[model samples]
Target: MRVTIFILLVFIPLTSFSALRFKEVFYFSERSNFSDSHYRNQRPPYYFPGNFAKEQRVEPKRWGEGEAELMEEALSELLSLPQLQKMFLFLARKGPVALKRFAEYPGRVPGGLGRMNQGDKKIGSVKMWAAEQPSFYVGVTDDFFKYMGHLDREKQVKVAKYIGLHELSHLYDYRMRFSFRDQQFLRATGWKWAWFLRRWENQYVPEEKRRALMKKVEEGEMSLRDLDRIVREQYGLPSFYSVTNPKETFAEVLAAYVLVPEAKDFLRPEIMDFLDGILNN
Candidate 1:
């Protein structure tokens, strides 16, 4: 989560009045691959691995060998979900993202379960970050998977699928540049859809407060404390982590909406309607 805050702090526009540009190509790198000495010798900006000489921008990459097959199999199963299928189709106008699975996500960046970059030439079915130092996207942690070998087959599949749904929801969040849904999420704060154009911070919090929260989390080692406060205050959000921010709220709820039978009651009609509009469009 802190890493996300740092990235935002660096990337935040100088003026709210200035125009913003959206990058269409989203990039993913396996943390292990990026750390490999041979790969690093030829790494592109932001650890993208393809040869940039052919194109000014390093061409995006996809999972290779056994990893590719694993992701394809998992995604094939995941798309069996109706809402997930529609959502990916809407996001991946050009194509599906090149899925690069890391045995463990890298420590350099703060996304708890995943990290994603956005650019828009559609890579195919589109698919698609947190704090203390800032992690987001709840998923199967390294510890969970390491010990997963012991679980019964049925329980193992259940946990893995739940994690996948959470990760997918985050991808959906990245693709939504502007939505009446987000505007509604922001409520009558007098903010508009355009405000979300390049801003990745929570849409609901003021800039100063958001930064302080991020810092407090990192410095105090109190990531869970903030969550406890939110639940204690009773924001009525569907998931405890969803209380982190609007982006997380949508992602967490979307995951629960798809996977948790009880999560259905927590969602509003407009949120689903907005999602439906994206799926159909």
Candidate 2:
């Protein structure tokens, strides 16, 4: 079956605003061959192949009964925002993004995963896998439903949209090669890249404070997670995972600024302003 996708562009002119507003319309058929198919034989601890161009073309997996509908709703809501729409279009310009599902893949996480294979776009007349096409593989495991069991349909959709936006934010950051301005902005929150160590380091706290925490952890006075949490909390990061690296911090903050209603209070004003400049400009 062919993959089906439809987009409706609505232009609304505002008296006060010079730019027009647009709403994204997405429709995905149940028979769409968009889901990933490389994991049929793979078992637990699935490893996503970094490059998608070399994978064999197998029958793509179909979504569970209601999964497609949920994803369609989620995508429509997510692209309604101008920032997200811009991001999607920017990536599409490099190469069309393929949406795939991870169907009950053992040990699969219950969220969206976005990856980009960066390479050349074309060799003569043929488009190459070297093109920077971003792919999104969404997984909705039983744990996802159990966690959202209490929320109504509308709320559940919101949660799904939030997760989708989070993953898209990652792709956007990747496509931009993690902008230097963004890196500088987040540096204030205590995330830094160590050239010598060749990894991200948490410098949010003072050296003295971190040393003290290390001593406590060594003495069994505090757990390592606790030490990390303390530094993350000092900057009011959205979650502990956000502090994993500057890229994650960018994704987490951007997602919150766009979807979370109370994000203005939770995130620092400077961070929100930075996102506004990037998305709007």
Candidate 3:
């Protein structure tokens, strides 16, 4: 009896570990192949006069003779503005590399490529320093200007400026919450779990339903198991992955706070109420 019990324990752990290894290998292979194809069509990485560059090589005047000059001027002015300056400084103190990158190339507008890898061309995505060094990278998808072709040149510039500030705010939040070690762990674990959880949450209950569920959990009327059941049956998320981790949840909360001030009603009321409850408690 004793020997059977020991064998079962050892066999189970070994089997689980091997499965995890296989999954990791599969994920890495798929991601690496995707990335190779994605970069194949990219530009050779040249430094333009202004910090921003479009993925395609246009005559640099497709917009007009003075468009590039205007963009640079606008970016310089925005950088010096008090609000932008404070936000940049906050990120810089946390990670110097991201600060330098932003200072050097504050905006990137990819051209002609209807969509970037992760998102459509209408909006751009930014990547901040991961607790490491001196530079940050922000990618602006072509979508930022898709419908704005009819808008005046000045309006386009203003839209870019606002979007840039929003991305910069994300950088600040990242630098504050994650340390070098924490970042390393996250990278090793991969973002698939987080992506999966987010999708699952959006599937069944809709974001609108999460607040009530969270409320129940907080009130002790619903146990963690109950929350897990709702997430699984209603949302179609794997129970283990959905409830076992809190990193993504914390980051989302922090990011929302940074982007939308508490005094404002920029976000949905339910989301704001849920976050507020977490914060106050």
Candidate 4:
């Protein structure tokens, strides 16, 4: 599990939503088990931003017995959260919510939280990859049973809910296509198009510092690992991983807003106001 480098909000433990009168919005049911041969010897790819090879070829595997039920429980809790329910519904309307678990590809990608496949068609819902080792990874490494061994029912649900929003928010970003359609969001997060590079660049770092940072990275004067450190130091963003880019920043901010109310104390007023306006709409 990746430890958060920017920890601005301390989570207050809350009781599971099972005790509340919760209405189910998204249903996580078992789908057809995936085999490489079923997809015709070609593994479907999952994607993320940054230089980590944009996407990875993935072979989807069926969730172990009873796993879908556990995931459903977590989804139910997610819907119970007042802050995320409307936004989730708004995003889901754009596409069907599909969840799949896959074998890890050979690489350094740690499968941090989960990934969105975004699928091939531009007009519909995309396939989503859940974490291989389940919620917290705990004592397990790619072993769901061992990960579960470390958590009782309550903690299991809590961990599931925590990751659930982050992954779902990725789907929201994909469905919305914020990069092309939402300039306000991108600008608010401090991302601007660099026509020269033909990609979006983080503007949180001052122009001079950004130029120097890139020069150092290209010349191997600075390690790429230091990139996230600089972004966090300059922007004091919600999370270290969010510093990766704007799409991730959007997801992380939404997840923090929903899961940690205290995040309001730390997030910039513009960000909080933006989230409030969008979610309420």
Candidate 5:
């Protein structure tokens, strides 16, 4: 019985949602089975930023699950906060959540992300959002932290929290509106910070090299081992995933903005203003 349950847990975490369903997709791992003791006494690196309740210490509620389940539930609770909720409401008002997609492809091999520093297509929501209607998904393999080299439970929570922050940044890329008949979708220029990231990518990465990078990404060639190289070599970006594209850069910055301690080192002065603008804008 224990063996059967284990196998089910291993393979059943991924529940697919068809593209045409227009319903949100949610796929999360049941990795960690941690208790309140794990984070109840711990402090959140930074306060979740917002106009109201601006300094609240935000952390995931305790659960009797593995590392993966903690990340999944933590994300839900984090997004439920009014601070984050308000932001999502604003985006929903603008684009409206008609046929909006939300899926999770968590890393589950237990050892590594065989190919791609990120994913076979793109890391996180960027790839799905890059689609015709800007569908989005947050991609994480178990090897992510192992590769980014973050296995600590608390740090893992921060990773999950930031994934939410980053993916929402991608959601804002499209304009969702309701027409007389049904709804209309249009492409819009992303945030100013995203544009800045593009310029940075262009300036730092030569055309040929940039093209090569794209090829590698399309081929899922980047690996966890490559994280150190990108982190050490990136031009002021927060994480290697940040270098993937403007959306990723924007999302990563968003993640870093609300972080503290281990992940807080990546924040910059301008990012403070950027974060404020995002919260208030």
Candidate 6:
């Protein structure tokens, strides 16, 4: 029985949602779960920013100093988490094996490039770069540490840890699971679609010139409804991509699970059912 259970654990492609569900139950069972205790210990006195501009300003220099400190602290704590350590080990082994098989195909993967890097300009948010060898670079801005510090410290740390885990998952996937050839195929598909759209746009008549054509498309004049169809159509693409790729979908699900327990309540019925399936499987 023990051998069977161990084999199941090793072979199963445990979804992020499933892992989170297990974590929830495990943490609940443990008397010293850090959720409440961590928060209570780290609570800080209130101090709100005086103005909107003050809040919006980006200061990379300042953020760098704080980010470094936070990163060190977070890394230390992360290394100590047994569950996270185990997950990392599993991914380290599993990711490369998956990638090797994927690399044999001469097509772009269904999802966009699975990796990204920090560019010359420091953007506040992380960005993805599609390349022969995809990699992710965590962007740190001046407000990074300050913003994190401002969070209900205990709650925020948990959030940060979750974010780190999610990003790490991506790293593992790219290193082991994603293939350059697959990405190239997907990129070609995207280009073909872009070309089709451009041709379609150019064929519009004089009465439906650029502005008018844009307005019409914006108003969904071409589609079944005369609503803002273009934006709506574009909005759904991410959902499709999320569904097709387990890595992307899992990372997102895991991030949400770690940061927001309330998310389980708000998820779509289909998604909730999916999560249940992952957990039970």
lDDT of each: 0.42, 0.50, 0.35, 0.51, 0.40, 0.33
Q: What is the TM-score ranking, best to worst?
A: 4, 2, 1, 5, 6, 3
**Stronger candidate by TM-score (1 vs 5):** 1
lDDT digits (tens) for residues 1-281 of candidate 1? 45544444456656632211111212334433333344455645433323223322222344445544443444555666655656655545633443443333323333321221111111111122211111112222233333322322311234445555556666666656332355654552223334555554433444465456555544655443444345324433443345455666666556656766654454555555555665455
* Residues 109-218 of candidate 5: C-alpha lDDT, one tens digit per residue: 11122233332322431212222121232344333333332232433444445555555566654332111111111011122223544543333444466556555644
lDDT of 2: 0.50
Q: Pick the candidate with the highest lDDT.
A: 4
lDDT at 105, model 2: 31
Off by over 4 Å in 2: 1-60, 104-157, 179-181, 205-233
Winner by TM-score: 4
Q: Model 3 over residues 156-265: C-alpha lDDT tens digits?
A: 23444444444444455456443122443233222223365554233234444566665665566865555544543443332212222334433333343433333123
Give the TM-scores of the predictions, in the order they appear: 0.47, 0.57, 0.31, 0.58, 0.42, 0.34
Per-prediction CA RMSD (Å): 19.5, 14.8, 20.9, 15.3, 22.0, 18.0
C-alpha lDDT of residue 208 in model 3? 48
How does candidate 2 fare on TM-score? Answer: 0.57
Candidate 3 clashes between residue pairs 3 or more apart in a chain or in different chains: 97-133, 97-134, 97-135, 98-136, 121-143, 122-143, 122-144
TM-score of 1: 0.47
- Which of the predicted structures, 1 or 6, would earn the higher lDDT when compared with the native? 1
With a 3 Å backbone cut-off (N, CA, C), the pairs that clash in candidate 2 are: 119-130, 190-204
Error of 6 at 102 (Å): 32
Deviation in Å, model 2, residue 245 alpha carbon:
1.3
Query: Which TM-score value belongs to model 5?
Result: 0.42
For candidate 2, lDDT tens digit of each residue in 135-232? 33233433333332233231123445555566667767767865334555655456666688776676655445545655675566865456544643
Q: Between candidates 3 and 6, name the one with more favorable lDDT.
A: 3
In angstroms, give how far residue 188 of model 4 lies from its true place. Answer: 1.7
Give the C-alpha miss distance for residue 245 in model 4, angstroms. Answer: 1.4
Error of 2 at 274 (Å): 1.6
Model 4 residue 86 lDDT score: 68
